[model samples]
Structures are given as structure tokens and as C-alpha cells.
Target: MLPSCFRNICKNSVLPKKTFGGAFSKNNFATEATFETKPYRLHKLDTSPSTTVTINREDAIKFYTQMNTIRRIETAAGNLYKDKIIRGFCHLYSGQEAVAVGIKAALRPHDGVITAYRAHGWSYIMGVSPLGVLAELCGRQKGCAKGKGGSMHMYSDNFYGGNGIVGAQVPLGVGIALAARYKGTDGVCVALYGDGAANQGQVFEVYNMAKLWNLPCIFVCENNGYGMGTSSERAAASTNYYSRGDYIPGIWVDGMDVLAVRECFRFSVDYAGSGKGPLVIEAATYRYSGHSMSDPGTSYRTRDEIQEVRQTRDPITSFKEKIISANLVTADEIKKIDGEIRSQVDEATKQAKIDAEIGLDELPADVYSQSLEPKIRNVDPFKPLVHKRLGAAVNI
Candidate 1:
């Protein structure tokens, strides 16, 4: 048997190539309308005055809406989990909304993205409706995975999944990049894993392959300090995950700030699309929830520690403050967005709860092969005439 931590992952890895249903399902699969190849540059998000880029009100509103949608969706999921309306292992992307918003801001629809299990935020920004994701959490047939893949196996269009097995996505990401190169497309792949997964051997192996093949891949390490409650300092010998890529130019980014993430991802996208090979960007982010929903995050880390991060570096609040202070958005506008998000989440949760969940029959259907025939002991099975005659004379 596989290790318990990886058993579910192995099962999910075999999902059949079928279209997932739900609100986002209308355009979930690749069709004629996929994004066009566009060349762009990767620009590091720098706090330095010299590197600052001006943002207008319209752009600010768009990003803020995206971030708010992720936040509200996750908050709704958390409440649903608490209410027992959702089951199985649920990982909330509460604190890491900025990372998704920032990075997605730099990507087009054709670019590929894959992330770790804490992937609700990424899915939200990728145009996967809140109802679709919530339906998956509720195990409804209207889910992104057609009610099959609970929290850890979400997929849409070019978005691969919220893969559970740490570090496994690295090599797969390189393969996607290789395919893009072979097709002569300007597409890039953003492969993300957590700080805990950074220590996995497969990550390094893929890093080597990506460099050797000159794949247009951006390996993002969402180093949130703690790997399933273990502090990064204790888990990793070298805390600088960005520098882990010895062969590639690595960028260390402030992941708590959306602007910072956007700037860094933009730079990485541009650099990779320019055929400069793979780049590594380590976004030092944090997860507010326990490893899964089961572990209380406060047990290993102090409540005070969590509170400190919330008060000091909450990404959404920080961005809101900046926008308001810079007069890019007003309080009324922010409140309007917040209200819309709240309503959207509430509707999604209600719809998800009402949708029919998938059953055990779904398990066998998505696999690569099926059992050929049923065994019958009471009577002799029908034998082919040719097979019987040939076997009677020649028994191999």
C-alpha cells in the first residue's frame, strides 16, 4: 500500500479525462476559444521607488474584486465545514488570497497553473465559479470535479489541480512546459508547491530537467513559514527557498502583498516566455488554517503568533488600506464589492448543498481499464467455437 499521506493523491491522480460540471463547467474544458499566445516580460515586484508601477482605479478594482471573491468563497467554505455541510479533508486558502490574485493578474487564460492542496484561492481567480468549488467541497455532481474530487483535486481549463502530493507537480509542470515549447507556443507554466514540499526530492529533480530542457516554467514556492504546523526554521536547513534553484535565477518575494506577488510573477512570466529557461520565485506566504481543517493551527504556533501575522500582514486588508490611502478606491466601493462577494458566496453554498452528490459508481468509471467479464460458477461460461476447436488440438 502507498503511504497514508499519498494514498488519496494516488487515487485522485487517476481521474478520467472527462469534463467537470457546474457554473464554471461551461468553459472548463479547452475548446476553440482558448487564450492566444502573447509574449510578455517578467518584472520583479520591488518595494523600491524606482521599481514601482502605477495602477489606475479600474485595475485596482479588478484585482480587489478577484481577491475579495477568493476570500469570501474560502470564508464560506470554512463556515460550511464547521456546519458539517462539507466533509473530508478541507484545506482553506484564507491567508494566501493575495498570492493567487497577484500571480493570476500576470497570466492569460492559455498559461497553465498548478498549485498545492491549499488551492481554493487559485481556482477562484482562474474563473472557476464559487458555486463550482463549493459544490466540489459539498461532493455534489455540480462540482468542478463532478462531485468526485473533494478539496484537493480541483481542475479547470489550463488549471491542473489542487494536487495533494507535495512536490509531484514539479515534474508534471516541466512536462507541460516542454509540450508548449514543442508546439512553439509562448505559453508558460506556473507550478506552485508549499514550503513543506520544497524539501521533496522530486522538486529538485524537476528543477534539473527544466533547466536542461530550457522549459518555460516558473516554479513558485509558497513558503508560508510552517509546513503542516512545523516551522520552516525547524523543517528546512536553509530558509531561503528562492536560492534552492542553483542553476536558475531565483527571486525572493514578499507574498503577503498582492502588488509584490504580481510584480514578481509578471517578471517571471516575461523572463520564461522570452525563452530564457525556467525561473524560480519563492513567495514567502502563510496559511491561516491548520494543515488540513482537522489540526488547530494554534497548537504548534501560538495564538499570538497567528494574530500578529493577521494584524501586521493580512494581504487583503493591507491592499485595501493601500488602495484607500492612495485614493484608488473609496470605502463605499470596497463595501459594495464586499457585499457582492458575500451574496455570491451565500448563493453558491445554498446551491452546492442542494445539488446531488456523486456516488461510488463514479469511482470505477474514471479509471483507465475495466474488468472484462463477470465470473459465473453455477453454469459453464459461453465458449467461442473457434477458441474451443483450436484449444482442443493445440494447448499452448
Candidate 2:
């Protein structure tokens, strides 16, 4: 709708492209860009994460690879569950790959992450390989939990359990932060929970305690629109979860954008690690699958809505498009990564299916860590066992 003169100026590239860095190269694109993707809203904070995230060939490759690997893993998990290869409650992290990948990109080795049952992506990011995750899902001995704890329980170095309880991990997150403080090591615990668990009384109590004790815990509420089949509107009075922490500072970010989410965590790591007490972050994200394998995701929401989010706001797709559009990487490179991941996932799934389940005798082995011998220490099973004599299942 511009006038002829302005249209001519734009078409001819006569106008100076001096806005971003220098004038656009002869290729008509800037080598780098800042302030791409969505903006973040802050609460009770003077500073924000860098508007421009680091964009280089290396990071672009890593982001696409990791995020897509997570997506593929979740997709494989869904298929496995449908095929009865995976039993028990299975929560897929298909739509929210960016949150975990971004956090991984920004995480330090000293930092710890604890999350709820929707932890496939976090588990991979926190050091468990895709093979380990799939093996765990399939109840194989090679799982991060050695198949003892299926879908809802996986852990690794510096990564806590994939707690089955709704909001229980928040206090454990505080405990981790308190330990870090006590040991004088600057470790921040990134605790994640769903919006459904946000309203849990225990979450608020720990929030208060974390702030009171100046614990370095980053409490993240992954608001993926619907908590199970119930929408957030029906579940919580106020959905502005970022500001839910009144006393503690909060930040809201576009969870669908990997770069913004990365910057959000980068800023958070610096802030919380500096003894800034706790932080509350509401990552506005979406979940393509149901809350668990039991709930059909389409019951409450329409197919069109999920389709729209997939087309528009999908973290993997959007980030891929952005990476290509920015010329950081090529479509061929993306395709190559896709193929590699597909092969990797297929191999992992094969292994997970073939791997043997833990034997009954081995069940008594990990009762305590390998370091602690049971006879010398004379310790009963650390985890309590309720023995219901169901015809004497086995004689250990």
C-alpha cells in the first residue's frame, strides 16, 4: 500500500539497511541480529536478559540438534506407549523442547535441575542420553533409573528424580539450594513444575521459605496452556504465574523461542548464582500431548488449536525456521541433523525394546548407592518397603 516512490525505494534497496549492525551485506541479510523472536515481560527486576542471544554456527547446530532430538524422543515415547511397549503413566515433552534445551545450553555443571513427571526432555538435557530415557520408558535395565523407575522417575548426575508428586519437588529444590549455600558452592537449583501444580499449597510455602532463607532456587512454572484436560482459566484464578511470586522476583519468557528461553536462563543463572535468593519464571509454553498417556490431548481442546500452535508456535519448527531465515545454517544442514536424529532415535528405541528388565536379585542391589555396603553400615532399605504378603512373591 505504499506510494510508488517508497515502493521503488524498497524494491531497489536504495534505503540504507543501517538499523541492524551495519548496512545489510550484498546478500541483503545481516550476518547477525538481536531482538529476534518474542519479547519477555519482567516483574520486580531492574535488568533483563540480553535482548540479543548468541547466534553462531556452533550454537545454531547444537540448538537444532538437541531440541529436535528431544522432540523425536517424545514422539517415539508416544508411539511406544501406544504400542504397549511402555507402560504406566507416560508424559511426553513434544511441544516444550525449547525450555529444556535452552536451559541446557545455559546451564553450568554445578547447577542442578529437578522436575516433575514431564521429564523426558529435562532428563536428556540434564545428562541422561536419549537411549537412557527411552530405555527407562521401556522398562529396560539400561534406563537412567535402571528400569526400576519407569516414565515418572529418571535421574542423573546433578539431576534429581522425575518426581511423581505434583508440587513436591519445589521443596526439594529449596533443599538442594540450601545445600549449595551450606557447602559454600555457588550452585543454583532449577526446579520445574506444571501450571496444575502451581496452585499447590506446598509450592507457596517453599516459595516463602526460599525467599526467607535466601536460597538460590529458580522455581519455573511451565504454563503449557492446559493442565491436563482442564484449561488454566478453570484451574487458577490468576494465570500470570510469573508474578505469582510477589516477594520473590519473577520473569516471563516465550518458552517457544529457544533463544529467548536460553537468555532467560542465562540471566537467571547469573542472578540466582550471585546469592539473589529465589526466582520465579513462568515459561509460557504449550503441550501437544495430553498431561499423560491416559488423557487424550484432544478431549478439551480442539484439533485446530493444536494444529495452529504446531504451525505457528512450535518450538522446534519455529526455531528451525528462524535459524534458516537468519542464514546461521542452511536447510540442508537442518535436514542432515533431522536424518541423524531419526537414525539415533530408531537405534535407541531398538535397544530399549531389546534390553532386559532388572532381575529380582538386582532389585536389592541399588537399595543404597554402590558406595554404601549394606552389611557393614547395617542399614535397612533407605526407601521404605511395605511388604504385603501376596502369596510370598519371592524369597530374597
Q: Which candidate's TM-score is highest? A: 2
Error at 82, model 2, angstroms: 1.0
Candidate 1 C-alpha lDDT tens digits along 271-364: 7998989988877667778888898887777776667678866778877876665555678889999998899899999999899866543443
lDDT of 1: 0.74
Cα RMSD of all models vs. native, in order, equals 12.8, 7.3
Regions more than 4 Å wrong, model 1: 1-50, 359-396
Worst 10 residues of 1 by lDDT: 32-41
* Model 2 per-residue lDDT tens digits across residues 153-219: 9999999979999999999999999999999998999999988999999999999999999899999
Best-matching candidate per lDDT: 2
Q: TM-score for every candidate vs. truth?
A: 0.80, 0.88
